[model samples]
Target: MEEVEVVVAHRDCATLRVGAVFLKIDSDQSRTEVEVRAMALAPIPTPEIRWREPPVLALAALPGRALGRLGHPETASSAAWVAAGATIRKLHDAPLPPFPERSRADLAAEVDGECAWLLANDVLPAEVVTRNRELADPALRPWTPVFIHGDLQVSHIFVADDEVTGVIDWTEAARGDAHYDIATLTLGHQTRLDDVLTGYGPGLDPDVIRAWWSLRCLRGIRWLIEHGFDPSLPGGEIDILKSRM
Candidate 1:
């Protein structure tokens, strides 16, 4: 048996890699259900599903390396980022999945709850949390929902030789605002926005994208902390929020 590499191990879920097969073990079966359904519906390249039983979903790993890490500069060429943008465009244009019950109102409530937790626990400075919370409010306004790769961080996108090979981690895939995907992809790497946007094509609302950026940071910090990550790192979630100020 190959040594199992722990991809992620948190309170609610865990994922492990055993050679070419990824075994995801989650406490929430609904998330796994959504992942399976989303993968079945997505138009883009995703990992092959080897099998699934209850809380464990087995998948074949993709061929290429991730596009980049969350806190580091992407060494991939601009063409790769552009390709990622195009891939996202294709995903956005695909038929909507049956998931996404999270409305803007729901998101606002989540933000409020998380912000209150941060303040109550002194997880972040009051001003920083308050200001970003205010900035994130506008993103709660209504927008056309589309099939989105709920978490499109660079690390989730795979590429080889400047071509997109596959995308992974579909647990968050749902019908949501399209700009949310764009913001998720470009969160910490603002410098690559132009490259991604170029391939994503025109007719996007920049302000909404920016607002999602703030919202993502605000919503992510607590989760990262809970997952044993320090969001205060130079390129961490806090940095993403501060950059917008």
Candidate 2:
């Protein structure tokens, strides 16, 4: 029998891997449902659903390895990164989902709260927090919405033989700014941005992408703290924030 490997475990959800199958357990079935719907909607390769039962959903493992993890050197070839970007472009070009993600006003408020929390808790120096807050401002401006994989982090993308094989973790998928996806994928890996943009085509604003990097890092710090993650690690969120300094 294959051993059960714990993939992820937190108060909100947990994921376990058993040989070729992955089991996802969520506190709220709505997220699981959304993941199901989003994977169905996605144009790129995605995991096949083995089965589902309420809070638990089983998915057959994808064939390729993850593109890479944050805080680590990326091993995938430049073409692989470009393939990931092209895959994202196809998804963005698809028709919009019926529901909307968080509005800009709500996101702005959240960022304000996170900034205040980070400062109050001494998580970072006030100057750093203040500067990042300023940098995050431009992302709050309006954008044309598109179908987006909300958490397009490196580890969620898979590649093999210089081709994007599949993408996973669709819990955060929603209709959002295309640049947000671009920014999220390139965060902490700035050099790869150009490679991604190659297959993603042109017309995206570099300033907006940079601003989203700041916003995402700012908003993520508090969550990382509460969730027992160390964003201060090398190449982690703190490093990403400090890179802009």
Which model scores highest in lDDT?
2
> What TM-score number comes out for model 1?
0.95
How do the residues 105-211 of candidate 2 rate in per-residue lDDT, one tens digit apiece?
Answer: 99999999999999899998888899999999999999989999999999999898999889999999999999999999999888999999998988788899999
Range of the 10 consecutive residues with the lowest summed lDDT in candidate 2? 94-103
The estimated TM-scores of all candidates read: 0.95, 0.98
Taken over the whole model, the C-alpha lDDT of each candidate is 0.88, 0.92
What's the CA RMSD of model 1 in angstroms? 1.4
Per-residue C-alpha lDDT of model 1 across residues 1-245, encoded as one tens digit per residue? 79989998988899899999999999999889888889889999999999999889999999889999888866989999999999999999997888855977788988888889888988878888888887877778888888998999889999999899999999999898888999899888888888989999986777788888889888888898888889899898888777766
Candidate 2 segments whose C-alpha is farther than 4 A from its true place:
none
